[model samples]
Target: MGKHLESDGPSSFSRDTVKAIISQFLGFLLDAYDLTMILTIAPVLAVVLFPPSSSLLATFNVIFAYSLTIIFRPLGSAIFGHLGDKLGRRTDLIITVLGLGITSALTAALPTYAQVGILSYILFVIIRIGVGIFAGGEYAAGHPFAMEWTPYKWRGFISGLVQGGFSFGSMLTAAVLSLFISTFGVKGLETYAWRYLFLTTLIPAVIALAIRLSMKETPIFSDLKAQNKIRKSPFLDLFRKPYRRDFFQVMLFMTGLFFYSYSLFAFVPTILEHKPSVFSLSTANHIYTIGTVAAFFGAVLFGTLTQIVGRRRLALIWAVITFIVSIPMYYMLMYGASIGNVAIATIAVIIIGIIAQGPWGMIPIYLSERFKASMRSSGLGFGYSSGIFLGGWFSIYVPLMHEYLFKSIDTPTNVWFSTAVLLMIGAVIVGIGQYLGPETLGTRLSE
Candidate 1:
């Protein structure tokens, strides 16, 4: 009886662990929803703010602003990651959530371009930067927080739950936009739709803040601190020695994953919406909604698979599947034969979502396992943020390259074809990197 009780204790689920996972998941959901909400409104904003004269340029400017935010994310991660490592995860999570909530609310209240001229654009950029800083910290802090609290056997599931939040957030944003657009009309949508979308950020952010406030520091971090084993300069320790190879491996892994994700999630919907020759706005929205739902289950599936096969092998499989199927997926979406064709296209979109997004579910576990608990937050933050920064730029540049090189918008098929090729290249790199990377299954935090 004593032996059975002792054995079961390690696998038992506790209230604190559940709380930590929910808090982290909620924070991720808010961030994901806010980021995608602005993206959904970008087309309408371009017409309103830039009109016909500078519409494309306005769209590019918004993309550039988003890219800048991605650039600053690493800085936020570094700052908050250090604090989380040195002080406590709960404290850093609270700070980030509060900052994100304030900035999101402020974004909703900002003046339009007609009302404030260049100042409106300037303020928008500034707000995005503020949000970016907090967003950067939110992601880095949450993954490690959840991973630390979770039992080793269930880490993959918890990690998937954290990753799955973004897809759920995206779905929620889609549902909200669908409702708002139906009731408000396009003109009303242009004026007030974005404000409501921004307002949605407050719900999860405030909830996460409250939940985090009630939580204690993880046992692993606390134990390390008690032993005086925490690194004095976590960033320096990551880059200077012993950890550099692992850092590079993380960068490679993230770069490939981010490249696939940012392109598919951020660019694909916009491309489909703006290019009516391919699909109407309503059709595009339906596709996105369906695709996002598919991605959510894909993440959950991949997360479960990781627990059985190990992170390295699962990542390799996802990459290979994406590379092989991307062209057919793009082809179906580009040229639908009938209503049945649209159904087929929808399935293709779902498969693409699964392949493109599966890597993310495993990344938190793979990254967290690579470092000692004392420096895990900092190392993972640096790796993840750097990949986002690089991948964000790739997403921006690829479309610009398509426009410049092809010199025509009339050819929707070519544009999508180009996008698929770019994604395939990223997949190949990910597959190769996984082959070269180390397997980190069943590793303990103390290692």
Candidate 2:
């Protein structure tokens, strides 16, 4: 505890702080919109962008588009993290939102396979990488920007409030896409509905960008600037002495979250859609939307609880719970014979969402508290984005593993079982990481 330990009323925070948090929340919505929409629309993209001549090529095109975005995120993280650390979080965020909005608009209007042949697929991927780069900068700047402005006492709750914005975005994307598909029908969705989905992302991006531009620099960053103590190269400094342990710990924490969340949210939907006999696309989307909405509230609840239970202990408890419940939950969801059985399965998934994503809501504060103001943005950015990029790749391999290892016993039940095993592994890893780290609930951010 230091000068920054003083408590302040919620209203004591300046308008700039409130505005910045709102902008960050909106930016998160846009980020989730693009990523989730890509996964949701993968089947459509495969049919429209790839030649219908071969099924293998179609799968490749869809997977390639999704994977490229995940792979390039870290590159964007490093680049934008440097700029954010040097210039300012606000300035870097402005550039990131603009890039996301413009690139998304362009991709929405991209040519179909019929018009441009292979060039259509090629251009889609190139622009997807661009979107990933822009998205890379968003959280790196936004999280630190929001967390740095809050008082120590309220950090846990506010961190959950801010990060919970991600679940809102996920729910919105799923709901809207489901509505669009229902209105347009499957044939129409493949034809033009997908284009409009990307186009809609521009609205939030522009609005969030405008609010960000109107906002002031974070109080922490401003104070550092006034003292002339800001690092000239904070990105490099993140890997040097003193800061390395904090960076690594946050990286491990985020890695477990990415593995757990991405596997359930990203991997499950795709698997369900591809196996239509087991679940329709719209049904899958509805399940995801419902699950994420529940998760959002879970995040808020768990985030608040961190203040009482301690961050490390809370994370460990949730990890173990998720690990134990995963297999039985999946078995119910996959093998149930009646609608009641399906309902139970869906409820099981929702429970997993609650515990799995709950700890994440506290991450912004935890990460922000770990670094000095000089390199906070860069360190958080690199650690968070790099963890996600690394953990996200497992989604790519999961499909292949399902195809090869379980080829003989290829059933929906087996697929769900495989998902459970991965979730269990994620829980074990997260629990161990939390055990290795210190309790950050009472730690004070450097002023």
Compared with the true structure, all predictions reach lDDT values of 0.75, 0.75
Error of 1 at 431 (Å): 1.9
- Kindly report which residue pairs in candidate 2 clash with one another: none
Point out where model 1 deviates above 4 Å: 1-10, 54-57, 276-279, 337-341, 405-414
For all predicted structures, in order, the TM-scores are 0.93, 0.92
Residue by residue across 1-447, what tens digits does model 1's lDDT show? 111222211355788889888998888888878777766667766654554555445666676677777788888889998887888778889999999888977888878877877677778788988998898888777888888888877877778878888887887877788777778866787787767767878888888988988888887777788888877888777887688888887887787887787656776666566543356555676777787787777787788788888888888877888888877876666555223356766776787777777777876777888877878888877778877756768646666666775435326323566667667877987887788777787777652
Candidate 2 — number of clashing residue pairs? 0
- Per-residue error for 141 in candidate 1, Å, reads 1.6
- Note the residue pairs that clash in candidate 1: none
